[model samples]
Target chain A: MTDIALRGVDGLKVDYLALVRRRRLYSALLLVLFVALIAGGFDLADSRNAGGFWSGLSQIFDFPVELVREAINKGAALPGNLWRYLPAMIETINIAAVSTLLGAVLAVFLSLLSTRGLARWPRLMPLFRRVMDTMRAIPEIVIALVLIFVLGGGPVPAMIAIAFHTAGALGKLFSEVNENADLKPIEGLSSVGASWFQRMWLGVLPQVMPNYLSYALLRFEINVRASAILGFVGAGGIGAELRVAISWGTGRYDAAAAIFLLLFLTIVAIDQLSSHVRNRLVGGH
Target chain B: MTTLDAGFDLAAAKRDAERRAFRKRMLTFGIPAAVLAYLVYVAIAFDIAGLAARARMDNARILLADMVSHKVHVTRDNRFDKTTVAIEGENKGTYADDQWPAWVVREGASTVVALEAGNVVRFDPDAVRFDIPDYGVLEIVQNRTGITMTMPAGATPEWINASSSRVTVTRPEGRLTVTKTRAEVFRYFGGWELFFFTLDSPFHGKDWAQLAALAVSGERVRAGESNLAAMASDVWNNAMWRHKDVAWAIFETVLMAFLGTMGAAILAVPLAFAAAKNFAPAFPVRFGMRRVFDFLRGVDGLIWTIILSRAFGPGPLTGSLAILFTDTGTFGKLFSEALENVDRKQIDGLRSTGANVVQRNRFGVIPQLAPVIVSQVLYYLESNMRSATVIGAIVGGGIGLLLTQAIQTQKDWEEVTYYIVLTLMMVSATDMLSGWLRSKLIGGR
Candidate 1:
């Protein structure tokens, strides 16, 4: 308003944002720098290890496409070992799905213990809240590692671990959603001697169902990706296979790369699906 | 009709009462039962109290115990990383070479020994005494699971301070005696936990390490070995290990999450402005970024890592970039939500004077959001410390690469513990620094 150089149009003022004007220049520089850095790293690694860098990089690109393809054609009748691989991939996704489901169930109970809405037992609520905080503080992988011994190295342990962590995460989110809910219905129901559970089921769930789904789906997507790697500890998945390929003698990396593509595409598909569903649910409101 | 309606009403009332009672009991009993279950798990883990309270350093007891059990082996381990195997059968078609660390003698020369420490040995002078001071306790177990010794039953084991300077035992037992060297071997290898071959070595001048370096030198060591010294070396050289190819991937991971999240933050501002009631109050922008976060953070980091690794291939760049996109979506949600929560009075005052939307934001929004943005950024940085960890593991990023390596090789656990500790320190430090920055930005108010 103080500067004449700045003009107003249609009750709106236009201002130049610095980052936008430099987008082209910034992107160009970023690309150049990224490539240079990567090249330099490979060069240095190659120099130091004689053939380690080439062997490693080759594993990323060369082996699987050649050896696995030949192996399948010559004797196995399977291309890229899909027959051996697909089940593990499905199991990985299942680990994420079941974990999310279990977490949702746990979160429902945890929400009741939280202070986001009801002021029931404020003292106990804080203590319980702190407990949730502590649970969240522990990393998911750590949870998985510990549970692995009891559950054995497979999807079950990973599911339990993911569930425990997601409960902490979803429980916190649920409490917040509850606190922001339209409190009128809840209070009215309570005034009429509706029990806490009944009030929650009727007043709270209706408002927060969308939220719960959004979180559960999100957690499921993550589990699908995580299961790929969780298998290195004998958990069994794409990641476990990837690790096995890396550990194999000579060069067998292309197989890992090929499978990684499938895993990535699956994630993209899941991402699109979740986005579509979330848009429909929240937008209709 | 009146009678039927009355009966229906009575039934409904009765059902409602039963439900209420069930719920009340659930809260009273169910919650406590769950707590009981959690406590049992905690007790088993030896980490029961650390759940609610901060962890205290209590390695003094562990360190003391280690010194006694470790005595000579710990000293030899200070130099190099290698593993040792003992061979007892010489004439059984097994190659008897000095280069091979094995024992071969007449059958009469072999002697029995006590498994537990500080037990009295009732030795017959007639028995052969073999000397083997280099083997560990587990190796001793490997050697002797079941044997019928003609010697008399040994006395009970006595309790004592680990240092043995203050020996304390209630009842002493007889010791099965082996030769001096054999006794030395058993003494060297015992007193540890599961997974003895993890790469979590602590280079505190141990004896076994020196011997390993001498035996396995130069090129032979890096051939993907599975032995004790390798495990010890992994722990001892962890800091140096950070320099290997894995380190670059880790840096890439951090850069990717931070930069990508920053990108989301940038986009979030305009959308957040549009969605806010004090500003655009429009349906499209405010809600878009708000949902972006739920979409981004909802999916797991592992998902992004796998996806990006596929799209880009396995490297720090893929992992990092995946983290970037995922984190941005999350940061956008948190940022936009924070924007929505901003005090409306500032915008209202500017608007009343006919100030334009752009001007209002500059003067009103940026300053208020600065603290929130910084705080949120710091929180993401801390949160991503863990995310970075998961990303690393997915492919070959950061310390996670080391973890995968250790597992595959069946390396010593001492090194594995070291890398894990290093990771914990890194995260803790980041968390602390973020907290400090947050307080400073908020002016400690």
Candidate 2:
């Protein structure tokens, strides 16, 4: 009887050990494969590149050095350059801010229309979801470029393009937040014979408002970057100015540096500000 | 005394409630009011009123129409007395003399174009004639002196714009323009012409059923190659559409996103450890690393792209590196925060067992961080696909470069539509893929 009990325990131990060994081996193999993939990808990219990675590495800092040196040489004009581009910088911010606002408002409707149980027409939920997905799938540059063709080069094209993307992005997030919301209020509002808009406004909006704001703020930061990029491709802003400055080559790099500094500072400021607000909003809850 | 105290407390509660109500009321009205004011200002600043004047409805109409339909140009060069029929008036799409579209027939000196909506345009050696269904026939003749137009009718319509050097008659179905050197007529048709196979290919005009039948048959389209192979090669190398180049561009964009994202994640892992307070005992190292990450992120991808493009001279490498540099900062910050949040008990448990620092981190910390790392990296991977398109435009490498080039030409709206559809597919595919991977790897988080 003692020998049989000992054999049973040994069998169990052996099986457990084998399972762990297999798991470890699988992990190791996966790691090796991952590393190999990275190395292979690097080699492929290097080969396809116009300039080889090794040769480009040395010249990576050349532009920045020249930019810095020129800025220093034209240190006296730095303030003037910054001031001159201030309006363009403001336009960039305004694009982000207005798009965020418009997108958030649009997202509120889309989220309400798409979320299960919360939707006005529950059957059309997938349709609305697909709409948002399609909108989100399209890159802002695509829309901005096309709109720039029709609307001409300006902030409006960038603003509309960014807003279109923002609506889709924020709508997805807003719907997710809506899913976790307390349905008791909505039920109670409906019990009181409230309209769909009233039920949503009075019940659901209050619950999801903080989260919506937090996500919208984060999106604003992203949109700022997007708007600037759109501007680079001819939609108007500080990015267009930066392009012009950079294209002028060595002599005008000072202006480019000034614009870069402004962009950097603005981005950092927004990043810090949004994160702070978001922490308070999320943590206070 | 008890009644007085109760009453006083009730009064104080009522006052507090009233104050709260007032604040809520103010907020209900104030936020929208503020938004409306801001929008008004933005409207003025962005010149919303002027936009109506500057919007160019004609451009919008052209873009919308061209995206769905294509036009074939039939020109009779008076100077050379030679006629040519080309799709979108491109040299690559020009038809050989023996094989013009059936709608366009050359009878001796004149070429007659049968347009839709009962509109017919005939391009002669020295004159162009347009026969509209409702309106009478309009004739424009190019003489040695100049161009002269005779509008059939009671009055000259606004659609016909005649100048000394040129005469243009525009209609919904087609357009005819007569000039000193040439008489041209454009006939509009729905659907993209020669998308799969150009006119030069043997498979160009074959229907799907015929192509499929031919593809399976033993007979070869070209002597050296099979029918299927010949068809594919023709489509892939189609000069007008450039399907092969577009496919390559799409791959390059995806490659940029993958390499940039994975590379950043790889590079960030070690740096994250150095930045994490629990892992790094030294404050200066953590502080410096955090600052470096901040500097990397603060400079923005735009700046990084410009700088990298200068070094790499515009390619996927520059775009990838730009993404790598920017995302490294983002991953470092996110990873270090995650590292800081790691449960110390796990490490302590490993340490209690005869594990060194390396072993403890490998066994305890990495397991805990794996899910967060995987989820974040996958999320960035999806987003980075979109970024790669934008970056490609700046660096001149990917589908974005193709898209911008198409748009810049200002005539290839159909090609632009193709690229847009492809880009949308690529992005959505990445999104779905990343979502699936995340769910699989992170257990449906």
The best candidate in terms of TM-score:
2
After superposition, the stretches of candidate 2 with alpha carbons farther than 4 Å from their true spots are: A1-21, A248-251, B1-17, B143-146, B153-156
Candidate 1: stretches off by over 4 Å: A1-84, A116-121, A146-151, A182-203, A245-258, B1-380, B394-397, B402-445
DockQ values for all predictions?
0.08, 0.82
Candidate 1 residue A204 Cα shift, in angstroms, is 3.4
lDDT of 1 by residue, B1-445 (tens): 3455644687778899999999998987996688567546534433334422432222223223332332111001112321122211112212222333122112232323332343322122232222222311211111222222231234322321112111111221211222222222222333432222212233223466664764466444445764445655565344423433444544554554454455445556665565555555566665675565555655446545544454455555555556666766666655666777888788889889999978888777788888888877777777676666666666565656565565344323344444555565666667668788788878772
lDDT of 2 at B277: 95
Which candidate comes out best when scored by DockQ? 2
Q: List all candidate RMSDs to the true structure.
A: 13.9, 2.4
**Model 1 reaches what TM-score against the true structure?**
0.51
> Which docking class does model 1 fall in?
incorrect
Task: Give DockQ: model 2.
Answer: 0.82
Q: Candidate 2's residue-wise lDDT over B1-445, tens digit each?
A: 3456644687778999999999999999999999999999999999999998999888999999999999999988887888999998988889999999899998787788999888888876556888898888787888888977777658768877889998888788888888888888888889999899988888888899999999999588799998988988999999999999999999999989999999999999999999999989999999999999999999899999999988888888888899999999999999999999999998999989989989999999999999999999998998999999999999998999999999999998999999999999999899999999988988965
Q: Which ten residues in a row have the lowest lDDT in candidate 1 chain B?
A: B70-79
lDDT of 1 at B277: 54
Local lDDT at B35 for model 2: 93
